[model samples]
Target: MRFSLRSCLASLLLAAGCSAHALAPRSPGDLCGFTEGRTVLLGNLVFMMAGKTTIQDGHNEAYVKQLYWVDLNTTFNVEGAIPPNVLHSTDIPSSAPYESGGAFFAAGNTVFIYAGLMGNSRYDWMWSYNAKDGTWSRAQVDGGKLNVDHRFAGLSAVAPESNLSFFTGGWDKPITGTVVFNATDAADTKWTNVTRVEGDDAVGSPRIANGGMDYLRLGKQGVLVAFGGYDISKNGTNQTETDHDLRPMDKINVFDIDSSTWYEIEATGEIPEARSAFCTAVSAAPDDSSFQVHMYGGRSRFRENATSYDDLYILTVPSFRWIRAPTTGLIPWTEDGVGRDSHKCVSWKDGEMVVFGGTPRKDDKVQKGCSRNYPPIRVLDTSKLQWQKQFERTTKYTVPRIVSDIVGGDETGKATLKEPEGGWANSKLQSIFSQTVARRPDITEVPIPPEPTDPPKSTIPGEEPNSSNTGAIAGGVVGGVLGVAIIAGIIFFLRRRNKKKNDNSFAAATPAAPPAPPSMYPDQQQIPMDSKDDAYMQLPGELHGQTAVPPRYELDSPIQSRNRTVFELDSSARER
Candidate 1:
């Protein structure tokens, strides 16, 4: 029999509906680059540097470029200039090439930009910026000492709350006292100068660039964690005690922020090799251990050649000792990692430390100021203690760069395409399509329920019959059947809607690599430390402590065991 036009149209509609429900959902990677199991959050890293100066002549004075900011995901997020023209001075004097910008601090919502110099010269001007606003303006400490030198000299701040910015080693000229300032109270700027040791002789002459003023906390209690510094001449000489100055204080110094007491840690394990100008950062806490202040890359005269180390040492603040980190597999040059120096490092809460862009091999190549080998950022997990390659790029960077100031927010992303990345952007079309699809829910065909049967009395017309039992029973059965079919149809439609919703969501997530465990030195516990008497169980007080054993990856590992992969930095080194 020939089909009618209405019948043909209905058949075509039914065929089309079947095709729509047959498709499967897209993979999560297609939606987002980060892996489904991982989360990306905002972290802060800052570094310290002297700014460039516009000199009148070749021999003119160098100006200090104070602060610069970076976004971890974007790399170099908020960077430009800090106020001071000189290394030590708060006042931007007319004679000054730039503002005597001293030091900087980042606490909770605000970043404190303090002004000062190396001497007693203090500038009252201060500035602060709300990380949310991304804007900056002048700020001040309520009753703060505006001393520029004390403000800018060797300084460090505590963790968790970047609020308490402290200044440790600086000049007292006639040998007044070593000052520690409190900038925690937004309204108070009182200068509390306490002598770590009495007199100039006992103070051992102020140490500056030797080891920048650093702080490590114990059980969250605030204390100044002191390490290596220029213990001798401004010319990088050994001054104080020939032994103490020469050995670079294998001794770790601890100063109480509240009390004016000084304690030196002496351990039985391996101590960190003495060096200065090295970088340091808090390590991601894998267990209940307090923060590990990881130090990397610095200059040293111990080696016959002008040496900058590619080693890592950790300060276990609670026990108050420095322990040589195990370097067997990860430190010197693992197949999966880069051997580097003068690079900046910062602790990322998600379980890794991100270190970026440092000059390798400070030999004649670096001494001649050769611009080469700025590798992509490398991340090391605190638990695993192994470096995982992440990001790389070739861009010109300013000097005296610090990692602590760089900020990564939740909105940030690390996308690796063969194109220049965006600071706060994505392909517009992708975003539009994603949002449109996400808002639309899929529609499914629902079956219609059968209509109930009418009572036979209807045929009797005005007879008013069928008020009887048999007729009522038949009507009830028909009603129940129709009701069951309607409910079943509704349920099927709801399930279909849910499946479509999940499909759309799958397209919106990011795809990232698999997560790794915290790093451990490959060689096991071979490193030295004062186990029994040490303040910290692992770290040693003096030069004697167990060294960290390096980590050795197995043949089944991803990069090393499988293939001979070659990683080339701006420097010249190749794997066979």
Candidate 2:
């Protein structure tokens, strides 16, 4: 066939355009704006809730109460073209316009958001986002004007089975007790306090903020696990002082729901360093016999001078053993630019853990950069221990003014960005970003049962439950069976050959070298006894000159001044 040069050139140009399009990095902004926000996973979508942003409000320092979602089915690819409508914001009418360090938990199709800092004060209100209908409504509870002390960075976990949500530790005061909220009973709904058992008088009980907590089902019962948060008890009663010595809670605490008791877990193996503002998610093994708490990215010490970590660790429950996940793919600081703290993470059924935005730490320096405007979304495959960049924001698009009391008012005012010249137009983008408004589903508000008046018996056993033991035993059994099968096959072959031939014709069998000692599991390797002790250890001579002296501010203070108080508050302490 005769072909014109003009046609051939056109064909080449078309192929080049297609190739470029195929190779282009998928923009996370195609789905939503870059935000350092909290995320909730429902079905195949991730709801990126309220967070601090630099783009929309002009000042670049305001917290926006905006809602965005990423269709996980589309954004799961590491290398692919930008998916349409993968990222979009919802315009649900929210009473408050600021939320940071708040508790976000989902029960059924409804997402429950508890108190978070709205402006400079902690908000005392509670709101729910119905994902099925994409509507936000204020929850009406019966407790005599619910008065929880406004606090931020507190930890919360919901027990749908018990129809209760538990809040613990915040910036206000050392919350000596776990705050229990009954959402089922609107008429009688109030915050109830669960007092913690006494610990050492000097050390006290855990009172922390910016910590991570999750509810895990152990066998038939549910347990609430708290890990890694900032404790400011040593800073005295002044809440606004920046000089307060904040430290990370190194110990792991577990609250047994059935028994209504708290106990500290002594996890062995390679426990993670003490840190706070990290994110955690629970994932059960395929067999559903045991689960793992996947923790990632938090500040190492005091928030101001803290070091960000990109490390991933898993604490196997029931066994209470820690395992440092050896991950591949993107290295946190190196590949992603810098490590992050205060990020949000959620786990899916396919063993994939998704981590959203947080503040990023600077490279080899204590000062973290404020360039987290459009932070990329990273996904970790827990089963394989590999990391992948799912989606990232590519363009700077204007979002509607996030009207909130925290920012004084509509900070964006009448200002708007000109729409990009090509692709999706401004109206199309707005349409894609329009919030879904469906009919709110009926929520059964069952009143929480009154607590027993008499002193309760202890439900905690003397020994810790070893849920992982069964899995280990099963592995050993399979290995043993395979070994036996190989040995039997060898013996049968030798016997059959001996029965059919003369023995003198055969050469002597060389003795097999003794099997090499089996390698130890990654957890079996020797690790530092204390997570903090290594911080003071001297650097080896080879690295002595390269490392800078660690920053010390309150080095001259008394040891007591360096220690924070831990509290177990009574129900009477609730804000009135």
True lDDT of residue 361, candidate 2: 49
- Give the alpha-carbon lDDT of every model: 0.35, 0.47
Q: Which one wins on lDDT?
A: 2
The backbone clash count of each candidate, in order, is: 88, 13
Residue 454 accuracy (lDDT) in model 1: 30
Per-residue lDDT of model 1, residues 422-500, tens digit only: 2212332122112110111211211111212431111100111223555664565456545444543444455457565
Worst 10 residues of 2 by lDDT: 538-547
lDDT per residue as tens, model 2, 33-125: 233355666444566655643331122323444666655433233322122233445553446434454556545455566655443443335
Cα lDDT for residue 3, candidate 1? 33
Count clashing pairs, candidate 1: 88
